[model samples]
Target: MEKEATRKKYNISVEATLEVIGGKWKCVILCHLTHGRKRTSDLKRLMPSITQKMLTQQLRELEEDGVVNRIVYNQVPPRVEYELSEYGLSLESILNALCNWGETHIIKKYGDKYAVLEDSILNQ
Candidate 1:
Protein backbone atom coordinates (compact mmCIF):
# COMPACT_ATOMS: atom_id res chain seq x y z
CA MET A 1 0.00 0.00 0.00
CA GLU A 2 1.17 3.54 -0.71
CA LYS A 3 1.56 5.93 2.17
CA GLU A 4 -0.53 9.07 2.17
CA ALA A 5 1.17 12.35 2.82
CA THR A 6 0.55 13.96 6.14
CA ARG A 7 -1.52 17.13 6.29
CA LYS A 8 0.06 20.25 7.72
CA LYS A 9 -1.73 22.24 10.38
CA TYR A 10 -2.08 25.96 9.79
CA ASN A 11 -3.18 28.60 12.25
CA ILE A 12 -5.33 30.10 9.53
CA SER A 13 -6.46 28.74 6.21
CA VAL A 14 -4.63 31.49 4.39
CA GLU A 15 -1.42 30.41 6.06
CA ALA A 16 -1.52 27.21 4.04
CA THR A 17 -1.98 29.19 0.87
CA LEU A 18 0.79 31.56 1.84
CA GLU A 19 3.13 28.71 2.64
CA VAL A 20 3.23 27.84 -1.04
CA ILE A 21 3.03 31.30 -2.63
CA GLY A 22 4.34 33.67 0.03
CA GLY A 23 7.74 35.23 -0.65
CA LYS A 24 9.26 38.17 -2.42
CA TRP A 25 9.71 36.43 -5.77
CA LYS A 26 7.35 33.45 -5.93
CA CYS A 27 4.22 35.48 -6.59
CA VAL A 28 6.01 37.69 -9.08
CA ILE A 29 7.44 34.64 -10.85
CA LEU A 30 4.07 32.94 -10.83
CA CYS A 31 2.48 36.11 -12.15
CA HIS A 32 4.88 36.06 -15.06
CA LEU A 33 4.21 32.40 -15.78
CA THR A 34 0.51 33.23 -15.94
CA HIS A 35 1.05 35.12 -19.16
CA GLY A 36 2.70 32.13 -20.91
CA ARG A 37 5.58 29.69 -20.81
CA LYS A 38 8.98 31.31 -20.35
CA ARG A 39 12.58 30.24 -20.42
CA THR A 40 15.04 31.21 -17.69
CA SER A 41 16.46 33.87 -19.93
CA ASP A 42 13.01 35.12 -20.76
CA LEU A 43 12.16 35.32 -17.07
CA LYS A 44 15.39 37.16 -16.33
CA ARG A 45 14.63 39.58 -19.11
CA LEU A 46 11.12 40.05 -17.81
CA MET A 47 12.25 40.65 -14.21
CA PRO A 48 15.62 42.32 -14.37
CA SER A 49 15.75 43.13 -10.71
CA ILE A 50 15.99 39.47 -9.67
CA THR A 51 19.39 37.86 -9.54
CA GLN A 52 19.96 34.73 -11.65
CA LYS A 53 20.68 32.63 -8.57
CA MET A 54 17.53 33.78 -6.82
CA LEU A 55 15.49 33.22 -9.94
CA THR A 56 16.76 29.67 -10.24
CA GLN A 57 16.04 28.97 -6.58
CA GLN A 58 12.55 30.39 -6.90
CA LEU A 59 11.88 28.25 -9.98
CA ARG A 60 13.05 25.10 -8.21
CA GLU A 61 10.89 25.87 -5.21
CA LEU A 62 7.84 26.56 -7.37
CA GLU A 63 8.37 23.28 -9.19
CA GLU A 64 8.63 21.41 -5.90
CA ASP A 65 5.38 23.00 -4.80
CA GLY A 66 3.68 21.60 -7.93
CA VAL A 67 2.61 25.01 -9.22
CA VAL A 68 5.08 25.29 -12.07
CA ASN A 69 5.96 22.90 -14.86
CA ARG A 70 9.51 22.82 -16.11
CA ILE A 71 10.20 21.41 -19.54
CA VAL A 72 13.60 20.46 -20.89
CA TYR A 73 14.20 19.87 -24.57
CA ASN A 74 16.98 17.88 -26.16
CA GLN A 75 18.91 20.13 -28.47
CA VAL A 76 22.42 21.33 -29.38
CA PRO A 77 22.87 22.74 -25.91
CA PRO A 78 19.66 22.56 -23.95
CA ARG A 79 16.36 24.38 -23.79
CA VAL A 80 14.11 24.83 -20.82
CA GLU A 81 10.77 26.50 -20.22
CA TYR A 82 8.26 26.92 -17.44
CA GLU A 83 4.52 27.28 -17.28
CA LEU A 84 1.90 27.03 -14.60
CA SER A 85 0.50 23.58 -13.88
CA GLU A 86 -3.20 22.81 -14.03
CA TYR A 87 -3.31 23.10 -10.27
CA GLY A 88 -1.55 26.41 -10.57
CA LEU A 89 -4.28 27.69 -12.86
CA SER A 90 -6.51 27.74 -9.79
CA LEU A 91 -4.52 30.73 -8.58
CA GLU A 92 -5.29 32.85 -11.64
CA SER A 93 -8.31 34.53 -10.06
CA ILE A 94 -6.31 35.26 -6.93
CA LEU A 95 -3.45 36.70 -8.95
CA ASN A 96 -5.86 38.91 -10.88
CA ALA A 97 -7.46 40.05 -7.64
CA LEU A 98 -4.10 40.96 -6.19
CA CYS A 99 -3.20 42.84 -9.37
CA ASN A 100 -6.47 44.76 -9.35
CA TRP A 101 -6.02 45.64 -5.70
CA GLY A 102 -2.48 46.79 -6.35
CA GLU A 103 -3.67 49.02 -9.15
CA THR A 104 -6.25 50.56 -6.87
CA HIS A 105 -3.73 51.04 -4.10
CA ILE A 106 -1.21 52.59 -6.44
CA ILE A 107 -3.79 54.99 -7.83
CA LYS A 108 -4.94 55.86 -4.33
CA LYS A 109 -1.43 56.66 -3.19
CA TYR A 110 0.14 58.08 -6.35
CA GLY A 111 -2.94 59.49 -8.12
CA ASP A 112 -2.31 57.21 -11.08
CA LYS A 113 -1.35 53.58 -11.51
CA TYR A 114 0.29 54.39 -14.84
CA ALA A 115 2.80 56.52 -13.00
CA VAL A 116 3.57 53.84 -10.41
CA LEU A 117 3.30 50.53 -12.20
CA GLU A 118 6.11 49.46 -14.47
CA ASP A 119 5.59 48.78 -18.16
CA SER A 120 5.98 45.02 -18.30
CA ILE A 121 4.41 41.94 -19.86
CA LEU A 122 1.65 42.13 -17.29
CA ASN A 123 0.87 45.70 -18.23
CA GLN A 124 1.07 44.92 -21.94
Candidate 2:
Protein backbone atom coordinates (compact mmCIF):
# COMPACT_ATOMS: atom_id res chain seq x y z
CA MET A 1 0.00 0.00 0.00
CA GLU A 2 1.06 3.59 -0.48
CA LYS A 3 1.00 4.23 3.25
CA GLU A 4 3.09 1.15 3.96
CA ALA A 5 5.61 2.15 1.33
CA THR A 6 5.81 5.64 2.74
CA ARG A 7 6.41 4.26 6.18
CA LYS A 8 9.21 2.06 4.92
CA LYS A 9 10.77 4.93 3.02
CA TYR A 10 11.59 6.81 6.19
CA ASN A 11 12.13 3.87 8.51
CA ILE A 12 15.78 4.75 8.84
CA SER A 13 16.67 7.48 11.33
CA VAL A 14 18.91 9.27 8.85
CA GLU A 15 16.21 9.14 6.22
CA ALA A 16 13.70 10.59 8.63
CA THR A 17 16.01 13.39 9.59
CA LEU A 18 16.79 14.15 5.99
CA GLU A 19 13.13 14.15 5.10
CA VAL A 20 12.69 17.10 7.43
CA ILE A 21 15.89 19.05 6.95
CA GLY A 22 17.46 17.98 3.70
CA GLY A 23 17.47 20.66 1.03
CA LYS A 24 19.58 23.35 -0.48
CA TRP A 25 18.31 25.89 2.01
CA LYS A 26 16.59 24.17 4.92
CA CYS A 27 19.81 23.48 6.82
CA VAL A 28 21.05 27.00 6.13
CA ILE A 29 17.77 28.46 7.35
CA LEU A 30 17.91 26.34 10.45
CA CYS A 31 21.49 27.43 11.08
CA HIS A 32 20.53 31.07 10.97
CA LEU A 33 17.55 30.49 13.25
CA THR A 34 19.86 28.91 15.82
CA HIS A 35 21.16 32.42 16.54
CA GLY A 36 17.79 33.91 17.49
CA ARG A 37 14.34 34.68 16.25
CA LYS A 38 14.27 36.35 12.87
CA ARG A 39 11.66 37.89 10.68
CA THR A 40 11.29 36.73 7.09
CA SER A 41 12.78 40.04 5.95
CA ASP A 42 15.75 39.48 8.21
CA LEU A 43 16.36 36.06 6.76
CA LYS A 44 16.13 37.51 3.27
CA ARG A 45 18.61 40.17 4.16
CA LEU A 46 21.04 37.66 5.61
CA MET A 47 20.77 35.38 2.60
CA PRO A 48 20.33 37.61 -0.38
CA SER A 49 21.00 34.75 -2.76
CA ILE A 50 17.69 33.06 -1.96
CA THR A 51 14.63 34.29 -3.76
CA GLN A 52 11.57 35.40 -1.82
CA LYS A 53 9.52 32.60 -3.29
CA MET A 54 12.08 29.97 -2.34
CA LEU A 55 12.46 31.39 1.13
CA THR A 56 8.72 31.45 1.72
CA GLN A 57 8.38 27.92 0.43
CA GLN A 58 11.23 26.62 2.59
CA LEU A 59 9.86 28.35 5.70
CA ARG A 60 6.43 26.90 5.08
CA GLU A 61 7.92 23.44 4.75
CA LEU A 62 9.92 23.86 7.95
CA GLU A 63 6.80 25.05 9.77
CA GLU A 64 4.80 22.15 8.46
CA ASP A 65 7.47 19.73 9.60
CA GLY A 66 7.18 21.21 13.11
CA VAL A 67 10.84 22.16 13.07
CA VAL A 68 10.24 25.89 12.93
CA ASN A 69 7.72 27.90 14.87
CA ARG A 70 5.96 30.78 13.20
CA ILE A 71 4.64 33.51 15.43
CA VAL A 72 2.46 36.34 14.35
CA TYR A 73 1.56 39.49 16.22
CA ASN A 74 -1.25 41.90 15.58
CA GLN A 75 0.05 45.33 14.68
CA VAL A 76 -0.35 48.17 12.18
CA PRO A 77 1.25 46.34 9.31
CA PRO A 78 1.29 42.86 10.82
CA ARG A 79 4.37 41.29 12.29
CA VAL A 80 5.63 37.73 11.91
CA GLU A 81 8.69 36.02 13.23
CA TYR A 82 10.24 32.59 12.93
CA GLU A 83 12.22 30.64 15.45
CA LEU A 84 13.28 27.09 15.97
CA SER A 85 10.91 24.81 17.81
CA GLU A 86 12.27 22.67 20.62
CA TYR A 87 12.52 19.84 18.14
CA GLY A 88 14.41 22.09 15.76
CA LEU A 89 16.69 23.29 18.52
CA SER A 90 17.63 19.65 18.93
CA LEU A 91 19.48 20.03 15.66
CA GLU A 92 21.90 22.60 17.02
CA SER A 93 24.77 20.19 17.49
CA ILE A 94 24.24 18.60 14.12
CA LEU A 95 24.04 21.96 12.41
CA ASN A 96 27.15 23.16 14.17
CA ALA A 97 29.03 20.07 13.05
CA LEU A 98 27.86 20.55 9.52
CA CYS A 99 28.96 24.18 9.55
CA ASN A 100 32.33 23.22 10.91
CA TRP A 101 32.80 20.55 8.29
CA GLY A 102 31.84 22.98 5.57
CA GLU A 103 34.31 25.57 6.77
CA THR A 104 37.04 23.02 6.96
CA HIS A 105 36.23 21.71 3.54
CA ILE A 106 36.27 25.18 2.07
CA ILE A 107 39.61 25.97 3.67
CA LYS A 108 41.15 22.73 2.50
CA LYS A 109 39.71 22.98 -0.99
CA TYR A 110 40.41 26.63 -1.64
CA GLY A 111 43.06 27.46 0.94
CA ASP A 112 43.62 31.17 1.55
CA LYS A 113 42.14 32.28 -1.72
CA TYR A 114 38.50 31.56 -0.90
CA ALA A 115 38.94 31.78 2.84
CA VAL A 116 39.84 35.46 2.61
CA LEU A 117 36.86 36.14 0.40
CA GLU A 118 34.57 34.32 2.80
CA ASP A 119 36.07 36.17 5.74
CA SER A 120 35.56 39.53 4.05
CA ILE A 121 31.95 38.70 3.27
CA LEU A 122 31.29 37.61 6.83
CA ASN A 123 33.00 40.71 8.16
CA GLN A 124 30.84 42.88 5.96
Please give the lDDT score at residue 31 for candidate 2. 86
**Which portions of model 2 miss their true places by more than 4 Å?**
1-8, 113-124
Candidate 2, residue 40: the lDDT equals 98
Per-residue accuracy of model 2 over 1-118 as CA lDDT, tens digit each: 5576555544668988888899899998998899899999988887888999999999999999899999999997999999999999999999999988987887888885464444
| RMSD values, in order shown | 2.1, 3.2
* Residue 116 C-alpha lDDT in model 1: 62
| Candidate 1 wrong stretches, greater than 4 Å | 1-7, 122-124
Each model's TM-score?
0.90, 0.85
Residue pairs whose backbone atoms clash in candidate 1: none
Candidate 1 lDDT by residue in tens digits, 1-124: 5455766668889998898999888888988888999999989988899999999999998899899999999997899999999999999999989888988898889998777667785463
